[model samples]
Target: MPERKILAIIQARMGSTRLPGKILADIGGKPMLCRVVERARRAACLDGVLVATTTRAEDDAVEWLCRERGYVCTRGHPTDVLDRYYQAARQAAADVVVRLTADCPMIDPAVIDQVVGAFLAADPPVDFAANRLPDDRTFPIGLDTEVCTFAALARAWSEAGEPYQREHVMPYLYEAPGRFRIFLVRSARDHSHLRWTVDTAEDLELARRIYAHFGGRDDFTWGEVLALVEREPSLAAINAHVQQRTLGDQA
Candidate 1:
């Protein structure tokens, strides 16, 4: 087990610019939010998983989802995602925070464990760790893990300015590079070609296609997703519409 209590904070909201109520959207016979929780729960290194959603009454449905399933849920400022994460960490008394998004339902638990393991194994000790996406074996889309210390997150909350900073926390640490001990993990296979996020209609269609392939199995692995997509190349083309976030891109 890891020394620091690893808390997975999944930032979610009912309103999405591209796909409204995407979190509440259905995939595999369950809400997208629940699927995200199920994947996070599969991580062996995580001590717990909490869905950090906004306090808006529109999101009351999300809270009810948690209550209905007996999963942990938290409420905070919707746009100010940084504060939301901070409050969630406080609630869980977490020392290490793993930032996940509710949009990423097919996020691999094994990938999360590998990153957490790397954080614990660093000799000089790392303030944070992440996978450099679009480089190594194509990490499945929608699955991003940022493992950082509570101390670092506090500093980010205090020092980080600008709306983008508040909107998408912790870019300062990764972009600053040498300021913190940062390490990147490469995927063993070319799984990065897979897209598993729900950002747009295209993305959702792809997810629906994937669900159809897997018959909405909750325990579906990353490999299984890739294999299905391989058999049906058209499924991968669903999200060929939107461009992915670039290194210089702001939230």
Candidate 2:
């Protein structure tokens, strides 16, 4: 059999309700979406990275940025993200798929490779793999990574009917444990306390501080950010009070 193509698809949009256009928001003089794309491309395990956005007129800016930056992009359903991921994977001819979000400007490429490695190493060959499974999350919120086979993605796309499952894109696979084998790769230490995602103004402030510390570079490792937070405990306090929306919460 030919080598499996591992594709990383970063889903982005300008219609965030918590922080409108958060994906286009600036961090270290670069858009958040660009930062995510740049970092994800550095993963040694990924064959390619694509920015998947919606066909909505508001997302035109996302497509424009991808074009200007010479990154591959695919357009799909604005709300039904399962369909979007399935279509993106199919179009890219991906045998293995990595799912990422533009809000995670601090996503670590090494962690991405780690998750992919775990997925590939599963004895029974899990249908889905992620650094932080829904219930047992250990990695920081922004460093979230999910890997799955194209067949699993297609299965979720066709079988999932709930709005949340369709919108969140992989809940179905893990939700029904008996149907799909799932694997969760956890960090040595629990860092779920850290919130680096750009979901609100305070979250953005924390991310900006991190980017500023790295001199606006996207190559910094997630460990470096952890150390920075360790030195300055106040940084994590910025969004400590911010409540993350539950899985059932609608867009």
Candidate 3:
């Protein structure tokens, strides 16, 4: 039998609805994509990290940056992100694929490990597992991580017909009850109210402020960030009003 390999594919593009070209937005002094990739690579569970971007002309910059930084990358359909992920995973021969987004600059490596550990250790073997999904998300939005066997991903790629399912990826596995066994990694407390993802102008500002608080350090733990927010409620309040768009809204 072949040794299992887990690959983290950080989906990125220059076309964010609220903030176009935000993938390269500077946080502290580094590009936000670099920060996300750096943090994700720290997770011991991931055998490799690949940046999945689109082939559109505008996204050429994304591919170029990956080359310059020596981060492995694969390109595919722009709107059909499920295809992008599927192709990327197939090229890497990834046995297991962990889905991440470039918008989450504050993504934690510990959380990635915890989620990957659960998926790896599942006795019955879940088809999918994620830190946050369709609903009841306890972890902050930025820490979102989705893990699925490449088989499950391949199935979704072939059968998922809805645009949202194709664009968001992994929804087909979890949206219908009992379609795929799923493991959800929830927080001990309800920190779901927090918004750490950089989806809008305010979100980018908060990310910049948080990184600045750590003096441009990229290795700060989520606990340290929580403590920082606790001490400075104003910081958490930066993008507190920013409403997260639902999959329905996104479609």
Candidate 4:
């Protein structure tokens, strides 16, 4: 068999209801989306990185930024993100797909490679793999990484009819249990108590501080952030009040 092409697709749009245009929000004088793409590109296991944005006029900026930054971009459904991912993976000829969100500027490349490694190393070969799977999360929220075979993504695109499944992507595979062979890559320690995803003003503030601590660099690892927060315990409190919305909570 030919070598599997592992592609990382970062889904982004300017239509966030909680924090509109948050993907473009400044983190150390650079866009959060830029930080996310930069870090993802550093993953050793990924074949390439692509920004998957919608065709909405608001998202045009995202596409333009991708162009200016020399990043590959693909556009698809505005709300149906599963379709967006499926189309992006198809266009890239990806045998394996790594799903990421634009909100995660502090996503660690090491964690991403770990999850991808787990997926590739599974005995029977898992159809889906992720660092956090539903309620069993161990890594910080921003470090969320999901890897799935192109076949599984195509399956979700075709059969997942629920609105949440379409918008969030990958739920149909994990939520259904026996439908797909799944793997969850857990961190050595539980850091789910910390929040690093940018969803609200508080989240943005926390991320800004973290980036600033690194002197406006995007190469900092998640371990360094953990150490920073450990030395300055108040850093985690910046967005401690922000609650993550689950699929059931989403409209």
Q: lDDT per residue, candidate 3, 24-50, as tens digits?
A: 999999999999999999999999999
Reference-based lDDT, each prediction: 0.81, 0.92, 0.93, 0.93
> Residue 160 of model 2: what lDDT?
94
Residue runs of model 3 more than 4 Å from their true location after superposition: none
lDDT of 2 by residue, 23-100 (tens): 999999999998999999899999999999999999999999999999999999999999999999998899999999
Error of 3 at 121 (Å): 1.2
For candidate 2, the 10 contiguous residues with the lowest summed lDDT are 242-251
Write down the worst ten-residue block by lDDT for model 3.
242-251
Enumerate residue pairs that collide in model 3. none
Clashes of each: 3, 0, 0, 0
Per-candidate TM-scores read: 0.92, 0.98, 0.98, 0.98
What's the TM for model 2?
Answer: 0.98
Q: Tens-digit lDDT track for model 4 on 1-251? A: 57999999999999988899999998999999999999999999999999999999999999999999999999999989999999989988999999999999999999999999999999998999999977899999999999999999998999999998999999998998699999988888999999999999999999999999999998989999999998998999889988997885632
**Which one wins by TM-score: 1 or 4?**
4
**Model 1, 1-251: lDDT tens per residue?**
44678898988888876688999898878898888899889999999999898999999999998999999989999787888998889878899999988988788898789889998898888988886533443477776888888888888888887777778877766767587777777677656656678888788778877877777877788778878778878878778667666433532
